[model samples]
Target: MANMNTLAPHVSGSTFGQVIIDTIADLRDRRAQRAVYRRVYNELSAMGPRELADIGISRNNIAEIAKQSAYGL
Candidate 1:
């Protein structure tokens, strides 16, 4: 029979536990980014057209602007 240790992946190198942890951390990061996007969108949307234009953003661009603000791109 094959070696039992080699039959299953060595957790020390390619850890199943680490994969779970990475997945959870990725989910949390995505959630936090969404929250930030929502907050900026709401704050911008709350402003009047005149207010938005004065800041050089139009109402139609609120979503794009919020995304740029949250993602810095």
Candidate 2:
């Protein structure tokens, strides 16, 4: 049989355990970004037309603004 160590390498270098941890961390970051985007959109949507105008945002611009806010220009 081939050498077991050469076949598997070190557990720390490339293993299912590290992959799972990285996947979970990535998922959590995505979830947090989505939550922030939702909160900002809701807050802006709650504003009346007049209130929004005071800040230079009109109803027509809400969608664009939300998109930019979520992911930059």
Candidate 3:
């Protein structure tokens, strides 16, 4: 009937809205993780070779270390 047709559209609209909200939330989380990765990488890169060696981190591994620290991978 007419009422059923109207109700179906409303439900579909609500689901679409939820999908948009979820996408935005996912994007925000990814941006935050990327910021953390960049910060850690920059700080490590600024250290001298001797300082890095003191901490057992080679310059070549800075990106991997930062990724692990940020994304827990």
Candidate 4:
């Protein structure tokens, strides 16, 4: 396996601006994923118990399903 520690950029060659940009990009991606999950969860929660059961989804399974659907699993 490759050693990731050795891949770290040296301080002399690193750019703080790039690091900040990367962090912001990651945060945006995470926010988008959470938004999708929340939407799915809300839709599922709005369904009646019988309706959810007909679709093979239970109230107890909403969280797991939301996560899997959000991440395209």
lDDT of each: 0.84, 0.77, 0.88, 0.86
Clashes of 1: 0
Predicted candidate 4 versus true structure: per-residue lDDT over 1-73, tens digit per residue: 7865343255346577876677789799999999999999999999999999999998999988999988887
- Candidate 1 lDDT by residue in tens digits, 7-51: 335455657668678778978998998899999999999999889
Task: Put down candidate 3 lDDT per residue, 1-73, tens digits, no spaces.
Answer: 3545443353454775676687789899999999999999999999999999999999999999999999999
Q: Which portions of model 3 show Cα errors greater than 4 Å? A: 1-14
Taking all chains together, the TM-score of candidate 4 against the true structure is 0.76
Q: Estimate each model's TM-score.
A: 0.77, 0.69, 0.79, 0.76
Rank the models by lDDT, top first. 3, 4, 1, 2
- Can you give the lDDT of residue 39 in candidate 3? 100
Mark the regions of model 4 whose C-alpha exceeds 4 Å error after superposition: 1-13
Q: Give the TM-score of candidate 3.
A: 0.79
Location of the lowest summed lDDT over 10 successive residues in candidate 2? 3-12
Q: In model 3, where is the ten-residue run with the lowest total lDDT?
A: 1-10
Best by lDDT: 3
Candidate 1 deviant stretches above 4 angstroms: 1-13
User: Candidate 1's C-alpha lDDT?
Assistant: 0.84
Q: Considering summed lDDT, which 10 consecutive residues are worst modelled in model 1?
A: 3-12
- Between prediction 2 and prediction 3, the one with superior TM-score is 3
